[model samples]
Target: MSIKIENLTHIYMPGSPFEKRALDEVSIDIQDGEFVALIGHTGSGKSTLIQHINGLLKPSSGKIIIDNVDITGDKVKLSDIRKKVGLVFQYPEYQLFEETIEKDIAFGPKNLGLDEAEISKRVIKAMNMVGLDYESYKDKSPFDLSGGQKRRVAIAGVVAMEPKVLILDEPTAGLDPKGRDEILDKIKDLRKEYNMTIILVSHSMEDVAKVATRILVMHQGKCILDGTPKEVFKEVEVLEKVGLAVPQVTYLAKKLKQKGFNISEDIFTIEEAKYEILKLLKGANNND
Candidate 1:
């Protein structure tokens, strides 16, 4: 479902000595079924904004309209709102406390008061989506799983909820290179299979460049940039100024252009760069 935020401003501890404005007149329209990446430095209000999307934090003064209804209005239940938007926080593994992986993954569905048969079915589906074996690992203690497995288990908990929109905050934090790849691929597959809208909060431009169709950049409580990944990354200096680096492939393409090679500047993936370079060499040889 599409989300519309207008004149959003969030104030913490209003009329107090420690008053802080987390979001300063921030507004954006998130289209449905789009893979969106939210980027910002440490305290740029990225976390605060996402919280408002799911009604975890109420905006002091603004409107959050989802699917054409202003749910930010009174008389709307937060539980009902969350039923449509699933949120996976940073280091979600810490929240998995059930005795066994099966129970933990089933926690969300069970909370909805589903029957045992349906809950069991959802648990199995979620586990398999994350590449976890249900037969071998379902009965095992979640605490016994490795870090990567634990992360997957945590994600399965959210998947079990079957929300229309999935919001993930730093989903690959603290993972090794291989773990990061596996998790990203699994998430991509889940989005494709379920046709769920995804809002990914992250710091890695490379990850977003590879997946997100649109990127939003925040700086010090305000959204400074918003566009397609290629459009946003075109301003590499601005991205770097905001404490985010451009994708390595974009950098390499820029360097090649400066070295008198006729290469496309919109390169974000390594494979795209390799293909363009090969074509450029062929054209140069024909000229010779």
Candidate 2:
């Protein structure tokens, strides 16, 4: 859904000695069903910002509006906000606790007070969304599944909620390349099938470049850049200074550009890079 954050600021501890402002009057408007990648260095308030979207952490100052409703106000129910905006924390596998895969996925629907049939339907749908088979794996113990399976089951828990906005915080962290690709692909499919807003908090610039339609760059609790990946990543020095890397291909293209290759340097994905390089090669052939 649409999210409006106007002059938002989050102070970690208001009166305590350790008081620190995590978000500094940040303001932005995110359209519905947009794929947004939020990135920054350690302690850059990226996590704090997503937490505010779902009302996990209330803003010390400013208002948050989701779907035209003021979710940050005192009267808004946190549960309602959470239902519409699902926040899947880093390493969701650590959150799995139910005995069976079915129960684990059903946990969210059960919490929502859905009836037996409805919960069963949601469980099956969510399980399938994560590439889990219901008939074969439903009764199996979640603990017995492989690391990837367990992670999928955990994601199923959030999918069952069918939230309008899905916020994933470092979802692929600590996983092998294959596992990371699997999770990222699932997210891409979920966005396409469900048409829901996707917010990705990640450290991998390549991964973000692959899926994000818009990028939000944070530094020291303030947003420094917000734009398309091509636009944001074109500036290499600022990102490097902030402890972030551009996609490898983008960096390679930038280096080529610096060397007077006359190449388009703003490509974000390998496929795009391949096409651009091939086009340039064809142009050289024509000239020769």
Candidate 3:
């Protein structure tokens, strides 16, 4: 599903001494099936903006339209909106409490009032979607599983709900390299299999470079940049001013270019750097 935000503004404790404006006239359009990466330093309103998308927080003054429905309307029900927009918060595994993995995965579908048979089917499907073997993990305790496994089960619970839009906030937070890669790969698989719109809020420029089709940069409660990864990463100076950094490889590429090497400063991934280096070497050999 596509999301449209127009003139969106949000405030905390409005009219109070500690009042803070979290979002300021923020507006953007997220097209269907787009993997959008939201990046910002702390207190830049990234979290607050996403909460408005899923109806977890109301806009102080603006409109949040999902699939052409004005979700901010009084007539709209938040619960109904939530069913279509599933948010997997940071460290989602901390929310798991069911006795077994099967029950945890079944939680959301069951709440949707699906029949027992249908719920069972969804649980199995969700497990498979997350690459967890149903037979092997179904009866196991979620707490007994490894950290990454627990996270997968948590994601499965949300997947069971069959949301059209999936929003993940720091999904790979606190994970080791292997665990982090596993989560990212699973997210990619989920997007391919389900064709859902994904909004990933992350700090890792490397991870975003690898997965995001588009990037949004927020600073001081305003969206300062919005474009494809290549377009956004090109503004390294602006990003750095906001306390954000591009992928390390992008920096390396920039330095190489400064040193009089013919390389594109837009290289954002290690693989891209390797390819460019090889091509440069080949070109030099031909010249020699």
* TM-score (all chains, Cα) for each model: 0.95, 0.94, 0.96
Best by TM-score: 3
Pick the lDDT winner. Answer: 3
At residue 83, what lDDT does model 2 achieve?
91
Q: What tens-digit string does per-residue lDDT give for candidate 2 at 16-127?
A: 9999999999999999989999999889999999999989888899999999999888788989889999989988888998889998888898999889999998988888
lDDT of 3 by residue, 23-140 (tens): 9999999999999999999899999999999998988999999989999999998888899999999899999999999999888998899999999988898899888999999999
Native-referenced Cα lDDT, model 3: 0.93
- Model with the higher TM-score, candidate 1 or 3: 3
After TM-score superposition, the amount by which residue 71's alpha carbon in candidate 1 deviates from its true location, in angstroms, is 2.6
lDDT (Cα atoms) of all candidates against the true structure: 0.91, 0.90, 0.93
Clashing pairs in 2: none
- Please give the range of 10 consecutive residues that has the lowest summed lDDT in model 2: 146-155
- Between candidates 1 and 2, the lDDT winner: 1
When summed lDDT is taken over every stretch of 10 residues in candidate 3, the lowest stretch is 264-273
Q: List the residue pairs that clash in candidate 1.
A: none
RMSD of each: 1.6, 1.7, 1.4
